[model samples]
Target: MPTGLLILLYLVAALLPLGLAWAQGLTPRPLVDELASGAGILALTVILAEFLLLGRYRFVARRLGTDIVMRMHQLLARGAAILALVHPFLYTTRRAPAPDWDSHRQFFVTADFSALWPGIIAWLLLPALVLMAIGRSTLGFRYETWRMLHGLGAALIAGFAVLHALRAGRYSADPAMSIVWLALLGIALFALAYVYVLTPLVQLRRPWRVSAVTPVALKTWEVSLRPARNFPFRYHAGQFAWLNIGTNPFGLWENPFSISSAPSAGPELRFLIKELGDFTDTIGQIKPGCRAYLDGPHGHLSVTGHSAPGIALIAGGVGIAPMLATLRELHARNDPRPTALIYGNRTEEQIACRAELESIASEHGTRLTHVLSAPPKDWHGATGMVSPDLLRAHFSDPEHKRWLYVLCGPAPMLEAVEDALIELGIPSRNILSERFSYD
Candidate 1:
């Protein structure tokens, strides 16, 4: 589906309950009371919808890009938390039982402890959940532990929010709206089950084994996987996958890595992993022939169907993973398009797959430019960062502006390159980038 249509569908799903509630024609309450109720209802719906935006759903990720989906997930979670926190305080109505004439309970908020307690609990937990997620990196917990906690906490919050809505909400008493809430809750739970249970079960039958793990560059390893059975995994050139090595498929001990090898290169999948976190730092220690599981072919970094006359690959450090995939695929296909690669690293030692890059440049006719921030005294390549000055040196030609620009790097570098490209009159859509960290 088109990205716009997917977004439209999401908005409809999130706001459907509100529309149904309004259609019920409940007696009008004070403006503040309505606002409070609306806030809570919207928050609940958005939280439920977040399950689909967690970057696990291939349909959503393939259409909207995993980076974009994850960023949206983080931002929307904060927005939902804020709305949920303000839900109770925005009420102007007194916390009392409905009078005889007010059968719909529109004139006053619920005083029943059973109905309000769930909302209170959910309201209190929402902020804590958001804070934990925001401080995940600094909390000093393992990534897997943090992920498990985050999932469980989100599930609890969704359950509590749903219970509160069903028992205490004014319009929730309507049969249609009640069913809507139940359906939404069911969908959220199913999403969790799909990710944790169903996917793992499926992976068990199509397991992969680590074929090789060799150091490629400074603190970076090239990990290769081949199917344990006669299974073939299909993927686009620049996509990524969640790789689990020497672990059960059901565990949370996996990390996302770009498929540095091209699909045309056959069933064996390769990942260029850098030493970053707990899982990645141990890549070199993982022995070959270990059991592994892959869950992906995610991201939207591919240059497959682009119609640009040329391809410009700009990468920094290990960000060259996807670019390598694209370049390899292009070479394998004997693609005749003009290609240029501007790869930047901190030092000569940090440049991954240097020989392969040089070979591609020499044999495949790709214009390769290597940039080093901290080069040795004898280094002869371009010096300094992948700044606008460096970009202008290679990409200043008018024809280059119309070429497809693909970038992957640290957030600062990606942002700087994107800004410089836009400043140089390259259309925003022509520049594609994916961040290494969603946070």
Candidate 2:
């Protein structure tokens, strides 16, 4: 689906409960009371919808881009937390038992402890959950441990919020609104199950084995995976996948990596991994033939349908993984479009696949520019960071602005290059980029 249509559907689904509540035509309360109720309802619905934005669904992630989806997840979680925190405080109506003539409690908030306690608990936990997620890396927990905690915490919050709404909400007293709350809760739980249970079950049937592991550069290794059977893994160039090596398919040890091999190369998948974290630091020790699993083909970095007359690939350090895939795929298809690659690293030793990059440039008529920030004394190529000045020197032509520019790298480099490209008159939509760090 197009991104705009997906957004429209999301808004309609999220606001459906609020619309139903408004249709009930209940007695009017103070403006503050109405605001409180509306806030709570919207927050609950947004929280429920967050499960689908976690980037596990290909229909959403592939179409909108995984980075955008994950970004939406983070922002929506924070927004819901704020709304949930202030929901009860905004109420000015009295919380007391309904009088004899008001047995339905249409004019006052519920005073029942059972119904109120769940709301209190969920309200208190929501902020803590958001804080933990924002500070996950600094809290001394492993990525897998933090991921599991985040998932479980979100599930608990959703359950508590639903219980509070069904028991204490005045509008939820209506049968239709009650059913809406229950349906939303059920959908949230099913999303969790689909990601954690069903996806792993499907992966079990198409397992892969590590076929080779070779050192490609300083602290970098190229790992290859071949299917245990005749399973075919279909993916576009410049996309990524979550890789689980030598572990249970359902385990939480997976990490995302861009596929370094072109899809046209074969069914076997290859990844260029740099040693950075705990799992990555031990990658070189992984033995061939170990079981592996891949959940992927995510991201929107490919240039498949682009109409640009040329392509420009800008990569920094290990970010070249996806760029390699793009270049190889273009070569395999014998594409006639002009191509240029500007790859930068701290030193020459850190450059991975140097020989292959040279071969591709020679064979495919690509203009390859290598930049080293800390070059040896005898080094002769560009010897500074990939700054705007360097970009202007290479891509100053007006025609260059019309060419598609794809970038992947550290956060700072990606930001700098993206800004420079826009300043150079390249349309933002024509400049595709993927950042390794979501934060």
Candidate 3:
């Protein structure tokens, strides 16, 4: 319903002015038309961008593979950027030389700098965002660094844009226009509040203490946290949480780690994190008394969403995180659903939680298939990655649509598996892939 409304709103927004121009039979000023259209487009773009960045909305997008939503967002951002560039050029008579940062800084410090002042700052901040979005591969910027800068840069942009709009005399002059602008600003603030302020604040007021931080390997650790007080979040077997370390609410260092423990294990939340980057590597170092803020129970790549009589589970390396939850749920429910897991790793030594997986499989009557890409000479399991032929030969009724494939792994592996599945005549919708970003 919201999706339909957005489309309808966009159509109306796009056509309303043209209709007005035709109905009034007045000479339409091209610059005015452009400016108006640009404003509308900019407003919509900023709203969607803000929405996608919000925790709840972002979770929904992740679950639904909200690519269409993102496409709309990308389109709007590009259009807004173009319109912003053209807006100044088109209104040449009204356009003045852009003041340098030094000159503008004093005006910005003054809270009364008009609605337009905020927008001017937003305009200045947008280039960095646009560049960063395209600068992932280049610019010598790692994903983590890019993400941090993006968040900081976006906040500044939104703040500045709001200020600019409020200060700009045209929109600011009318009370109703101001109200509408304020309403949009309020919604943005609400999202930010829910993610950063309200959620964390509530959690902190009623804390969830760190239970343990145990090392699984040289670089991987399992950090468990359980509620010290009443907690409302009831996560599915495979969902994750955004853990904020060091009592820093605005730190924005939230990372999605799969709940390594089963939902049947009660309120105790577990996360197995590999020390690959700056965040996970140091997770073991966090002291027991240190306060941690959590903001999730997100990601819907769980048994709850899929209801097939049988299941094909695929994982690579640490991608087995969600499968832990899925297996647990299956075991707890006594779901006689025959499930097969093709867990892939580089070597036998790196096969994490192997015993736990085998035990669960035994208890639930689920079969475990180990695929070692680069195993030792004595390795007895499948010698290579999961291929269509291997799957077809090993599994019963392999070609049926009644079986759902839950794939979670590195992007390259997942892509290959998806391609292989398609080649074997399985429908794309029957295959679900979980995006496990170490970001």
Candidate 4:
């Protein structure tokens, strides 16, 4: 829908200028006019979609509809580059009393380097951005580093494009065009400054404190935090937050961890993290009194409005954090919604919050089932992976497909479960799954 609206707007902008020129008898060559207008529109559309809309660096991007937003920006940026190279040529060729070949060569290749410098910088920025984005993981660039470079690149490209358009004087000759350009640029600039500058600075002022850290598994730990003041923003179950560590208010080193403790379960927030890289390994060493900053309460995998006769939750590994929070939230609400949870781990040791989960389930009239893939000898709980057969054997109405199925687990397990549900003729909307890409 957004793509289609963008294309329609592009066509409108492209044709309006050409229509005015034609009516005023400015150009006799129809083909040249059409080509110039089309290229100009394509360039503007790309500018609007890429740097202006989706690429305005924000903390929410990491948790929001990030994948789709990023893909849109990449596609539009490439398209803009192609249009930037074509528009000037078409416009110059169609001008009245066309200049000599040498005159054309001078303007295209040599004249007014000051006016052209910004465009040159934009061209360089494009490929650099593409390289960084594509090679982000392969090049070992951390999220914060990529984010900083990404912001700088976007700002340069946008600033250059705005200057280039005004200097060329072709698109901004009219009042309407000038106003539109300014409005678009203003919006983009505001969003960029707000997200990259203002928000982080505000967070830096009211820093949180790390109160406790306990090892949950070989590579996983539970972190406890308290705000400098009592937080008014109440969080729902299964929501996550972006934790900014070190002196990095620049958004270069932030990680999203689901709140393992329910808001009702405690005054402080708890995050269950697995040591995947440089950040998590040193997280446990963070002093209890050290100030921290958090931006959170995101994700919508909660138990709100999900009132079926029965509920089923499936978690794998650290994914159990959100499910545990959900159960706690339900317990707090005094929701007598009969709920069953199936938690999976590689071994019994990897299962986080086992006792806590069992206690919560028992206290709240819920059922907790543990599923281990590689349990040691003398293990008694449901062994092997949480497969379709396992679910069928354990639950009375596994195939009924009427109960609410909220799944938080590894992608592979979620994929398998989704496939299993489809195989059992369940509607796609009936199943809700959360796939965390924290790694």
Candidate 5:
């Protein structure tokens, strides 16, 4: 689905309960009490929507991009936590049960433990979940482990929160509101099950086995996977997949990696992985013929359908993975358009597949520029960074602004390069980029 439509759906879902409650036409309450209810319900709805933005749903990720989806998940989660924590204090209604004559709960609010316990549990859980997510990188937990726990924690909070709403909320007293909340909760839980159970079960039939694991550069390796059978996986250039090696289809050790090989190169998939800890640090230990599973062909960064006059690919470090795929595909398809690859690394040793990149340049007429931050004293190529001045020197012509530019690199380089590209009179649509790191 398109991004705007998805957002519209979210707005409708979030406000449905409030609309239904207003339709109930119950007695009026204090403005602060109504505001408290609105905040609580909105927070719950946002939490439910977070499940759909789980960063694995292709319908959302393909349109919004995984980086945007993940960023949205984190940001909205913090917002929801704040709302959940403060809604209770915003209430001005009396802390007492509904009177014998007041069946609509207009003037009274339940302070009973039976109705408040679930809300209390959810209130405490939300902040902890947000904190864990914020500090996850520093917590020394495996990505897979943290992801599994995060899902479980969110599910727990959703269940408790909705239960409390149905039991205690003045607006949720309406049957329509109850149904909406329950249905939304069901959808959220099913999303979790789909990622954990259904997707893995489907992958069981189309499994792969590692064919090779060779060191490509400093602390980086090229791992190859060939289908055990005639697996028919098709992905565009500059896309990625979740790779689980030597683990069951249901295992949590899977991690996303950009496809380094072109799709035209048969059933084998290639990935250029740099050691950054976690599963990557153990890449060397993964031998050939180990069972593997892939859950993707995700990401929206591609140049397949563009009719640009030329293409410029800027890559830093392992961000070259998808660019390699794009270069190989363009070469295989015998594209006539001119192409340039600007690859940057700390040293010459950090450059991966130099021979192949050069061979592409020689055979396919690609212009290859290598930039080194820590160059050797005798370095003949471009020294220093792939800076704005270098970009200006190469793309000095007015026609270069119309060329399609694809950039993948560290966040800082990407931002600097993007700003420079826009400054060079390139339209925003003419430049394509996805940050390897969202934060």
Candidate 6:
């Protein structure tokens, strides 16, 4: 779906509870109490919808990009936490319910312990959940363990929040409002089921085997995979997949890596991975014929549908993985459009597939620039970072403004390059970028 339409749908979903409550036509409570109720309702609905963002639903990720999806998940979770944390304190209602008021429009808060405990549990856990996510790396937990904890923790919060909503909320007393909360809860549960159960079951039938693991650059390896049988997986050139090497499809040992080979390069898949600790350190140990599984083909960092007159690719370190896929795809298609690549690395030894890149550039008339931060004596190539000055020198041409710019790299480089492109009059929509890390 188009991003604007998807955003519209999200807005509709978020506000649906408030709309339903308004339709109840109950006597208006004090402004403070009504604001508290609004906050709680929005918090509940948004928390439930947050699960769908990470459910591996291609529909959401394909349009918004996985990086965008993850950022949304984080921001929305924090917002929900703030609202939930302040929900109880905002209410001006009396401790005991107003005896004469209708059950669905009580002017006083309920003091019943059973009805309040679920919200209390959710309220207490929400902050911890957000804090754990924010401090995931600092806590020094394994990626797999942290991922498992985050999923279960969010589910626990959702369950208790829903329970509190149905049992204690004034708007939820109506059958119509109760049905809405139940449906949202069902959707949240289904998102979890789809990711953990149904997706893995399907992946079991079409497995992969490691074909090659060759050192491509300093601290980086190019891992290749071939289907165990005749597998039929198709993805865009600049997309990525979560690889579960020698692990079950349902396990949490998977890590996402961009497909470094072109889709046009037959069925074999390649990933250019740099050892950055964790599971990546084991890349050199995996022998050929090791069992593997994939759970992706995600992200929206491709030039497939653009109509730009030229293409510009900016990559740093292993970020070149996806750009290489795109470059190879363009070569396979025998495209005649002008292309330029700005690849940056700390040392010359860290440049991946140098020969292949040169061959492509020579044959396809691509302009390839290699920037090194630490060049050896007598080095001739550009010696510096992929800075804004360097970008302006290469891409300041009038015609280049209409080009489609693709970026993949560490967060800092991506930010700098993207800002430079936009500052140089390139339309923001013409720039496509995918981050290599998510927390």
| TM match of model 6 to true structure | 0.96
Give the alpha carbon lDDT tens digit for every residue of 273-363 in model 2. 9998868999999999999998877888899889999999999999999999999999999999999999999999999999999999999
Per-residue lDDT of candidate 6, residues 83-138 (tens digit) = 98888999888878547645655667887788899999999989998998888789
lDDT of 4 at 17: 42
What stretches of model 4 exceed 4 Å from their correct place?
A: 1-40, 43-47, 50-116, 168-173, 246-251, 365-400, 434-439
| Candidate with better TM-score, 3 vs 5 | 5
Give lDDT per model, in order: 0.90, 0.91, 0.65, 0.69, 0.91, 0.90
Steric overlap count per candidate: 0, 0, 18, 1, 0, 0
Off by over 4 Å in 5: none
Q: Please report how far candidate 6 places residue 244 from its true position, in Å.
A: 0.7
Give candidate 2 regions above 4 Å deviation: 103-107, 436-439
The number of the candidate with the highest TM-score is 1
Clashing residue pairs found in predicted model 4:
144-252
TM-scores of all candidate predictions against the true structure: 0.97, 0.96, 0.78, 0.77, 0.96, 0.96
Model 3 CA deviation exceeding 4 Å by range: 1-27, 31-36, 43-49, 58-120, 133-149, 162-178, 230-232, 246-250, 287-290, 388-399, 436-439
1 or 2, greater by TM-score: 1
Pairs with steric clashes in candidate 2: none
Candidate 4 per-residue lDDT, tens place, 262-300, comes to 788666888899887767778778778767777666666
lDDT of 5 by residue, 346-372 (tens): 999999999999999999999999999
Which regions of candidate 1 deviate over 4 angstroms?
Answer: 436-439
Displacement of residue 193 (Cα, Å) in model 4 is 1.6
